[model samples]
Target: MTERLMNTLETPCLIIDAQRMDRNIQVMADMARNHQVNLRPHAKTHKIPAIALQQIEAGAVGITVAKIAEAEVMAAHGIRDIFIAYPLVTASKIERAIRLSQRIELIVGVDSLAGAQLLEQIAGRHGHSLQVRLEIDTGLRRTGVLYDQAAALAAEIAGMPHLRLTGIYTFRGSLLAGKPTLDIAAAGKEEGTLMVQLAERLRAQGIAISDVSVGSTPTAAYAAAVEGVTEVRPGTYVFHDRMQARLGACDLEDCAGSVLVTVVSRPSAELAIVDGGSKTFATDIQPGTEPLQLRGFGHILELEDATLARLTEEHGMIELGPQAQAANLRIGDKLRIIPNHICSTVNLHNHVVMQRDQAYKRLPVLARGMLE
Candidate 1:
């Protein structure tokens, strides 16, 4: 950002570098293209319709969202092709999905016969054939069905009166077996291989499996390389975070979104407090986590010798290292902090400041808190 523009901003702000973000988007798009896999970047990361459209224009086939409400928000903003990556169980939610499917190219996820049956009953009554992707448990162990039961469940879902099982997907971060590992390529390749093999098995049984989608930002690149995989949905690449940088997904310079805050207080030579805290940054990607071993709430760009050691509702405690103590920092100094998890941090804000060259614009976080 230009210094003149920077002086006009308020403290505890969310700023997105448009040029860097566009580069990040294109890089992911190019990766998918080179591997011949569809790039369906997840919209859950930014939750901004403008950003989603930017990704689509860059090369994304569509956008993937974690909730139907988010899909609705995206669709409202002229996003036609969407995948509800999560399973919708309630009748009202399925009804919403059915309504959404009527207007655009909609695909929902199904991991069980029960979920699939509910969709079938509702869609059948509505006289609509709802398209779905079978979510198989490749090892994330969250919402997907077990690998052993995938074939049976998929077969059951494929036979449903109003449901069409056209694809299978799994979301496993950089993990091997069930444990996190630094070997992202191996984990990604494994994810793609598992999904592709499962798709082949289902196809052999005349199930007409078409899309074998897999991957998050950490795994999208390698997974897309696997021959039979049809699509990859990587969310965090749009604004690479500290966690992604540690995971080797991107360099720290690649991080495009950051919290801009002013030094609020200086309690001691080693302790400088910022205007942003838990209310400004995400707390989910906590410090001292395994695998990555992230040490702080965020990475301070200007002060590499300072750590965002703690945060309350509106106070960020920056523990200045020995190198930082000699710098003689003062109050009212602005600092840009790259949060550990930009996606969650984004949910806490109503709008983000987009910067390109010296120009700036405020974009609403339209899909924020659309958890339902």
Candidate 2:
């Protein structure tokens, strides 16, 4: 019989079951391969180089990072292909980008002519050409140039010396919340279609838009169906969070990452305190028009069905549900918590403990707190 793995961890530690993680990785890889789309998982979900290597070895084309420092870290770990999926500007930053290009294939997102020009100058000075993706504001409205202006921006990026306009990218994270009945798949398809239309318009204007990347765990399933999208960059699909769960992207059992906490005190009949707090969990609430008011930082996993009842910063309060609470839970009893946002929660810890049955090992979060 296989030994239970949770018995070995200390409180307030992030524990990842290796088997579960491999399954998640394989599921996404198979999905992308079967659908004929490139899998470039966002490394921001788990900054560990070992995990990133596992993803690459499992058939991911490359890795995605949100910051220059993260790219630097991954590059040090020998990850040769990286996509910085955020709009970047600044002489110093562009210089760093140019240097990174020398070490690995680098792709940065650009939404404005000014940003593109800066990158162009840096690349020119370094005697290097850089790959860039024009971001389109496809209803998300957080970043990217206006969809109508995408062609113009592409033209500018294409005209710049030492800079190549690779394609376009967008985040459908905005669609993850709202009435559970909302069809995010349809919204994702529409967003992708709009991006493809813009890319086609750019091509008509004599600009070569070679790649179109669209992603969000909620919409990745349908994103692959978008006619013109060449690659899907869904990060959270590897470790489904509470938001992903609510969006119907993954069942609770599919969540591979959780915070291990020990019950410290039962302050009141309605309140119980755990060792994990904001320091362990993250402050990022769910995304939507009326976001789910997550009461605490993270949710307590009810073992029977992996349901979470309530959350607080330092304490995860459980509302006794139909299934009896595990009688094994007592003072000092360790419980696993499914975080609201796996990416941010993972960012909080410097290391993650990997468990397989009765054996446990530690892996450095290698790129933790690399916010630059």
Report every candidate's CA lDDT.
0.92, 0.78
Q: Considering only N, C-alpha and C atoms within 3 Å, which residue pairs clash in candidate 1?
A: none
TM-score of 2: 0.91
Query: Which lDDT tens digits does candidate 1 get at residues 137-239?
Result: 8887789999988999988888897898899999997843478898899999999999998898898888999999999999999999899999999999999
Q: Best TM-score goes to which candidate?
A: 1
| TM-score, structure 1 vs. true | 0.98
- Which residues of candidate 2, in runs, are more than 4 Å off? 1-5, 174-181, 286-297, 303-313, 317-329
Q: 277-367, model 2: which lDDT tens digit per residue? A: 6777776664232445553445566544323344456655554334434344567767778888898998888888887667778989999
Q: Number of backbone collisions per candidate, in order?
A: 0, 2
Off by over 4 Å in 1: 175-177
